[model samples]
Target chain A: MSNLSKPIPPAGDQDALEVEIRGKTFRGADGDAVRAIDEIAFSVAPGSFATLIGPSGCGKTTTLRIILGLDREFDGRLKLPAGGGRIAAVFQEPRLLPWRTVEENVRLALSDEDTGRDLDDLFAVLGLAEMRSRYPGELSLGLARRAALARAFAIRPSLLVLDEPFVSLDEQTASRLRTLLTDVWSARPTTALMVTHNLREAVQLSDRIIFLTERPARMRGVYDITTPRADRDARWREATLPALAKRYSGVL
Target chain B: MAPDHRADATDTALLQRPAALGRPVFGPRLVTALSLAGLLALWWIAAIVADSRVLPAPPAVAEAFWRDAATGELFFHLAMTLMRVIAAFVLAMAIGSVIGIVLGMNREANRFFDPWLILFLNIPALVVIVLAYIWFGLNEAAAIGAIAVNKIPNVVVTMREGARTLDRDLEEMASVYRFSAGRTLRHVVLPQLQPYFAAASRTGISLIWKIALVVELLGRSNGVGFQINLYFQLFDVAAILAYTLAFVAVMLTIEFLLVQPFEAHSTRWRPRRAGS
Candidate 1:
């Protein structure tokens, strides 16, 4: 159901490769240093969806920030593919410019040539076409989140990083947005990495799930969901998924 | 999501409703006219009770005003006073805004000017006017300069605060979008700076008028303050009362016609929260 009008290069054809993090430690204030993501070595395959799940303060956000070049002081070597295209992030908050209209907020992320996508269609996909002229203050929380999603997708980034993107959304809106996000990723197939506390969301959205241990996080487990793309139905409620949930519940 | 359909429907219905009737057009004007009438009545009553040349009745003040108007003397002096005040205010705004913006951007410059600006703010207007007259020999230049200098400190303080509170997020957005300096100034900076500018103008206008009056009384040959001085020398209480009432009327008109409208326009974007 993707409505991308123009041909976008495959994630592989663009700069598709792996991001490796080696022994990253982040120190908080009060002179107490926590070795967040110690000796964490993982590779994000191009055109694959990966989800990082762990307890709160388990270095999920820190890992994502390190990959995004936002946290450079960490002791790690992050190997990104050559000639990285636009890297756009969907923050936990919508972070839409309060003064701009919804349409303008989405348009702000796009270059001149990338504006070829039908804005009306994009908004319609997110159920936001009618609210295009409304400011962020005028929009409901769901619509604002949809606007933020549309903005992230509008830029067509090679790497799409989401940090608890749907934390505060109601279940129905969150589910709808999750479906829309899957459809968008399936179309363009960007190297997507999302960090979530919800195991159900991780199972539903990710090709590979990486679970982390408590504070000074380490990769406790990795689950490769072998479910075929077409046959995965109610993936979170599947019989085998519970076993995996029971297996990783303690680390979380 | 089950959209808050009920709330949306109510908002839409509110938007569709016919506009409310316009406000009563003459309410404020009527209130002002009545208040002025009350003040005149009080003056007349006081004059009748005092029964001396120290206080003049409304009719006596009116006669004095009419005599001056007929001779074109009142208009000439009023015009001269207004011209000096306007010139001084303009110069103060220009110089103060420039200095304030520079100081706001540079911490070192702000520190350098902090003591000096505080000194200017604290000095009495009458003392400054006397000093200007003594230093510059009672010329028009000296009169206007004194008023301008007295007004600049207030404008500088206001503009500096405005610059300090500017949103860094908005600036970053502008930078990411590669907006030119002119566009950034026009759209982002100026809109944010509007409240400060409006405040500066309001305070500056009132101050310019007060300082201009002091300068005229001390040194200048023409203007309302000079005419008041002349009336005092002749012991003409009626003339003095008429001139004072006329200046108050001018100040009130400026407040209503210019400052109020500008303030409303500039702050329209600010949201009104509940209980505000």
Candidate 2:
């Protein structure tokens, strides 16, 4: 078990989110009490990437929902960043409107039509250039996921929340999507929080990693991935995450 | 379940050769035309067997239709009935859709009015039409109001189901992006409800026309149903058959030309389920 040490950011970034969760208890359909999350607290600096890694059913998605303000029924305090910018989320499913084409789905997030050129560029970058007219039902799951990403980043969100974006894809497609995500995030820097189960993905994409315990979720461990983005390659993950895995034991 | 020959032929035709736009194969159309010819033959035989003026031959009814249409009386009555249908359909859809969305969005309102909706839905169209004429005195307003009231409750039920089935995940997407209410409605809410609207409008038009006929017969003059009643009093069987066939032709035109195309446009994005 890790000790409760609040993540204090640099003195200048004092206004970033310091999420202090006291408890979140939910009852199952049968009226039996289920402890989904016990107690947790952490802080994330503005404009940095943080990944939450935990076992399946550890309520990582729940915590993301709480942060996004979709699930306010949870317990504890979420100190949103000062002067909150726009927030956007990519849920586990694409959740695109089946009737709307890919372009329409992406355009739904955009309020200013002046970003038309940028939208075009975003579509090209995501390999969705030719798919603009196709409906979600027509696209393969990977393409649909890319369309989802386009919709998320098209808004130019200040706080982009991704919940297991690469789940259930072929490893090849997942890597491609991850690379696209990295390029897009680099082009438009935003504070992002991702929930993924893949340790290698957590190590490669995040500035810091927060490991969570199983149900009645609490912070199990936190690690800083000091490898810079250009050098955070597969070798680096192979070299580092196993040692970190031992340090956090079974949480990873 | 009973076998549906049209659907069976269309399905095999779809599989063997995906036609340009799901147009039924020519074989089925020929079959249908022959089937209709056979129906005419049967009716002709029946009229001969009865050998009474009660059931006139098809050619006599055709002559009656030609005479009525040439005099323009049939067209006039059809126009009157159609005008009432259009008015009642629009009014019911507008008012019922608003009430339904209100009930769906607000839990307390839904709780309060759900029972009332059930009560109104169960009320008979005839009773409502009679009550409307009694309360408002056989005026055009009462006639249209009665038809609209009979249709509104059904629309409410349909639209309420539509509102409830709206995807929550997409709503959360809208919220996380902070989309404006107008944009949310146009892009998110309305698209999801398209199928429901399609269902409502398609069925609503059918229901409105039937109720309109009842109202016209019970109260109004110079409409198809009223004209039919007048012919009935005169015992002109050939005229009755001519009017019925003309009305059926108009209804078929509306169904095939208007409602069917709209249905295709709305649900085109989805894949073909079993028989559609």
User: At residue A166, what lDDT does model 2 achieve?
Assistant: 94
TM-score of each: 0.72, 0.90
Alpha-carbon DockQ of candidate 1: 0.13
Off by over 4 Å in 2: A1-15, A112-117, B1-26, B105-107, B272-276
lDDT of 1: 0.77
Worst 10 residues of 2 chain B by lDDT: B1-10
Give the DockQ (2 decimals) of all models: 0.13, 0.60
lDDT of 2 by residue, A90-173 (tens): 889998988889998888777654335357788899999999999999999899999999988877666778999999999999
lDDT of 1 by residue, B1-276 (tens): 112223334434434444353323444556568888898789788889999998878899999999999999998988899899889999999999888877877799999989999999999988888888899888988888899989989999999998888877566445434345775676667777787888899878987897788789888788999999999999999999888778877887888788777776666444444221
Model 1: CAPRI class: incorrect
* Model 2 agreement with the true structure over B27-53: per-residue lDDT tens digits: 565777898999999999999999888
Residue B19 lDDT in model 1?
A: 39
In angstroms, the error of model 2 at B156 is: 1.9
- Output the number of the TM-score-best candidate: 2
